[model samples]
Target: MFGVAGRISPGPIGFDVTMIAVDQPTVARHGLTIVADHTLGDAPDLDLVIVPGGITDAVERDDRVLAWLRDRARTPTIASVCTGAFVLAEAGLLTDQRVTTHWDDVDALRERFPALDVVDGPRWVRSGHVFTSAGISAGIDLALHLVGVLGGPDLAVETAHRMDYAWTPTIPEAPEGPQRGT
Candidate 1:
């Protein structure tokens, strides 16, 4: 809801979010099969890509998915929700970068990807074009931050207001490295 529906001030603060999958009739970790708007093969070019976390073992090892993420490495922004950071790290996109994931997966992510400087407290962390969130709800905060960056702070505030979310609009600083926006 950080896009068109979030427009309260009406100043061009809208993003066209699309759901893409490596294959159709994709089943989530909870066994909920979802029909995506596009598959990787025919997906249109996007300015931002947000990968949601789950039981991501299969997708993390899929060559097609990795290749697609690598190809989209130059996209303005690439973000992850919770364990999705593992997939990005697997694709070699988060080397030497500070990132975060779900609280429960923090140690595992740190162990699996030694190259990443995984921090534990931040709801979300941003290093250059890559953004990673702590867990499910943190993704919403990150998306709102993205809206603030892409659109404007006012729009982000309006979105939070409309959603009745207690959005602080403040981003936590990474332990090290530059936090650049898209």
Candidate 2:
């Protein structure tokens, strides 16, 4: 997810991206060892903070990560991809805001954070400075949207074209009512 966001920037968007983690030598769920470029304590105050979702149960339990998220939420534009919304919700950041997570986790998110207005099917949804995307591929869509927000529609389109990605400028409305099996 960070890779997607990072790639979008410093091209036409002109954003300086950084990868930070709560700890160094971070091992991702897929067993990828991510040597974080910055630790939470060492990261500069950010204009944007992106939380990429994976292993939500583990992340939601990390008080230190939640604390950092809570602090950063006050200033930067915070975003979450997939189950990362759970992390933001755990940090008390998603209360009463419309959000979406991966389709598979939407019910869990709503059950866990009843205060959150959890929407189900948009590729991504934005409420104020916080944005949440549905799943993995949707993160790229959200990143493109952010580029549109920060840069401009033309730049976003250009960036998309440069990457050979078919970017959708507008997200369709999610269907209303309980999803199947809910």
Candidate 3:
């Protein structure tokens, strides 16, 4: 939900060349605002950083967000949903990392970030510091995965069952070797 960059749109007042902000609240509700300052992950700091994504071109190039993401990298948990993978990828955190995103965005994500082992249709992925989800709907699944990892199996199971949900990840075939995290 941390949208560091602003959304843009066509300008009013006959200014065809200049654009206007698209009222980020329209897109990022729940008390959205520009991040005035400060890098993330100083010590006595963040436990987990969640980057939820939106427009691609704008987010990929944001300097502030990228720096924070890189800072957050050394911290314990860094997770993303949907196109937020763009933020993590932009930070180069995905180098040699296997990750996932909304199913439709994976190809372009890979095209934009070749260093990442971006899979085709997985609901999510967890590799080292990065945890990503395909949550084009299944964000809850991804969140549950984090809950399982952080809180242990029983809490995760209870959480999922509370929603009357079954944990069904779209796992791509594990690579040629035994799985690394298992």
Against the reference, the lDDT scores of all candidates come to: 0.82, 0.77, 0.59
After superposing candidate 1 on the true structure, give the runs of residues whose Cα lies further than 4 Å from its correct spot.
4-9, 171-182
How do the residues 70-108 of candidate 2 rate in per-residue lDDT, one tens digit apiece? 887765478889999999999988899899999999999
For candidate 3, the C-alpha RMSD (Å) to the true structure equals: 13.6
Residue 155 in candidate 1 has what lDDT?
70
Per-residue lDDT of 17-128 in model 1, one digit per residue for the tens?
6889988988887699999999999998877888889889998999999999999998878899999999999888889899999999999998998988999999899988
Instruction: Show the colliding residue pairs in model 3.
Output: none
**Descending-lDDT candidate ranking:** 1, 2, 3
Using TM-score as the measure, the top candidate is 1
Q: Top lDDT: which candidate number?
A: 1
TM value for model 2: 0.85
Against the true structure, candidate 3 reaches a TM-score of 0.66
Error of 1 at 84 (Å): 0.5
Question: What is the number of backbone collisions in each predicted candidate, taken in the order shown?
Answer: 0, 0, 0
Each model's TM-score?
Answer: 0.89, 0.85, 0.66
Q: lDDT of candidate 3?
A: 0.59
